[model samples]
Target: MRKQKCGVIIIAAGYSSRMDGFKPLLKFGRQTAVERVVALYQQAGVDQIILVLGHREDQIRPYFDNQPLDVVVNENFAEGMYTSIITGVAHLNDEIEAFFIHPVDIPLVKRETVKELIAAPQQLSKGIIYPSFLGERGHPPLINIKYRSAILDNKQGGGLKRLLALYEADAADLPLIDEAILMDMDTRADYQALLIYDALEAPNLCECYAIWEKHKLPENIRRHCQKVKQTATDLVAQLIDKGETLNRPVLQAAALLHDLVKTEKNHAVKGGEILRDLGYPKVGAIIAVHMDILVDADTAITESEILYLADKLVKNDQLIDLAIRKEMVLNTYHDNPEALKKITRRYHNAEIILQKIQRIIG
Candidate 1:
């Protein structure tokens, strides 16, 4: 089948009055906010891209020099964001089947989210595909080019949100697991938080559960993960009180998602790979070693250690003594010598972690 021709309109014309800085030029890791947004669509194979600039256009215009996308100036940008949308939609190529209107302030949206939106219109006959996270709609709604005339002709009192409401019957909400879809930079504090979130590369608590629902994890595994998360939380509180610094969020997310691929062979590694691909390398690293982590006299009491120990303490959603857990493991593999050897090694690793936790908390 021929690939759908996708395009994007990145509106970067708003005054940074609330942000106290240029929203498009702010650095998010290595790239500026606008740069990141452009790269997102470029990587998603968007055939055409038009950036609408108005306020401080000169400052942001040079960034896209010789780039693949066309840059248009929205002289009436001060009128409202709607003007920029009209400018961007007018510049879209005639052959473009559908397009997305993204704002420069929402730079952290995952690339996977774009791909999903691009693919949604194929299965469902919808004019607009709004990405909804936890029932909240978010930026960069993928719009069918058929609405180009309606948008250009719109003189409504409200902005795009209000105008789009008229076409609700023709629109469909595509539920996604990306929390970044709902995140945007409206103030300095929000920008700082987004920077930290970008660095951590892990999902928030709500997004983690959304992932579980998206993957359709069995009810039993979900219960087990909840208990593991609780166990890790207790360990984090105790460890923090003892002057041992640990990343509680990373540890808890790993604990909850460690068994993501539990029904598959080599589930620990598989689950880790899945998370790493989803942009949570830190959580992935912890889950990767949850099944059989390396421990020694020099091993520190980090988040990985906490997760490893917490998982061992929980047996099928119930916290059990490490000794009883080991006994059950041994009995399960008693008839197979090779399996027994691996099980014994895992138990030994769990004991070392248990001892370290006891030493810290006591």
Candidate 2:
């Protein structure tokens, strides 16, 4: 089968009334909001991109002068976003099979999300595909070109969302691990939060919880992970006071998701694979070694070491002494000599990390 020709329509014709600054020109990292959204689709190998501009058409138009995309001015953009949507759709090429309607304010939507939506199995069958995170639908719905006329003829009061709602039977929701799908820069405070979120390479607190809910982690395991997160963050705080630089978000997320696949064999490695697949290699690396991390004379107090030690210190949902935790493990595996040796090695590794942390914090 041949690949579908996908395109994206980015609506950047808004007044930025709620936001003190122009949403498209705002900086997310080094790139402007409009630049990032355009880059996202470009990187996803979009066939044709139609950028509909209106509010500050001339000012924003120059930014894409050399870029390979069609930029159309939405003359009636001040009327509403629906006008911009139809303006963008009208410019889509005849050969484009499906297209995504994206708002410029939602610049942080992951590249993987676009690829996932485009490559969805129901792309041909479904008229609309909504990217959902934690059961909430979000920006940039992928619409089949067949609905080009419907979007152009949309006279509904609730905008694009309500117009799409009319075709519920023809739509399907594609659940994604990305929390950025639900994030938008509506206000200054929202933009500030997104800036902080963009700084971290790992998943944020909300995404971590969403992962747990998606995997259906049991209540007991959830409580244990919560305790581990508290213990790990507390350690991070003390260590930072001692002038130790650490990635707190990475550590916290790794600690919470360390036992993600506890029921599976080699759960540490399995959990790591799961997280890495979800676009979090940093957190996955820490969880991968949470069960049996290598500790040596040169081993410093790293995030992996901190997570490993934190896991050992917590039994179930309670923080217990390492010595007591080690005893309980040995007692459970006393009958198997090989298992006992492995357990001893793991406890010894934890001790090395604990001593390293204690030496600095004390």
- CA lDDT, every prediction? 0.90, 0.90
Q: 1-362 in candidate 2: lDDT tens per residue?
A: 57789999999998999998999999987899999999999999999998999998889988899899999999998899999988989899999999999999998998888988988845446878999998889978998888899888876678888888888998988888788898899999999988988888788888888889888999999999999999999999999999999999999999989999999999999999988887789999999999887887475579999999999999899999999989998999989999999999999999999889989899
Q: For model 2, give the 10-residue run with minimal summed lDDT.
A: 118-127
TM-score of each: 0.91, 0.94
What is the C-alpha lDDT profile of model 1 across 180-202, one tens digit per residue? Answer: 88889999999998998887657
Worst ten-residue run, lDDT, model 1? 297-306
Error of 2 at 35 (Å): 0.7
Clashes of each: 0, 0
lDDT for model 1: 0.90
Evaluated at residue 303, the lDDT of candidate 2 is 95
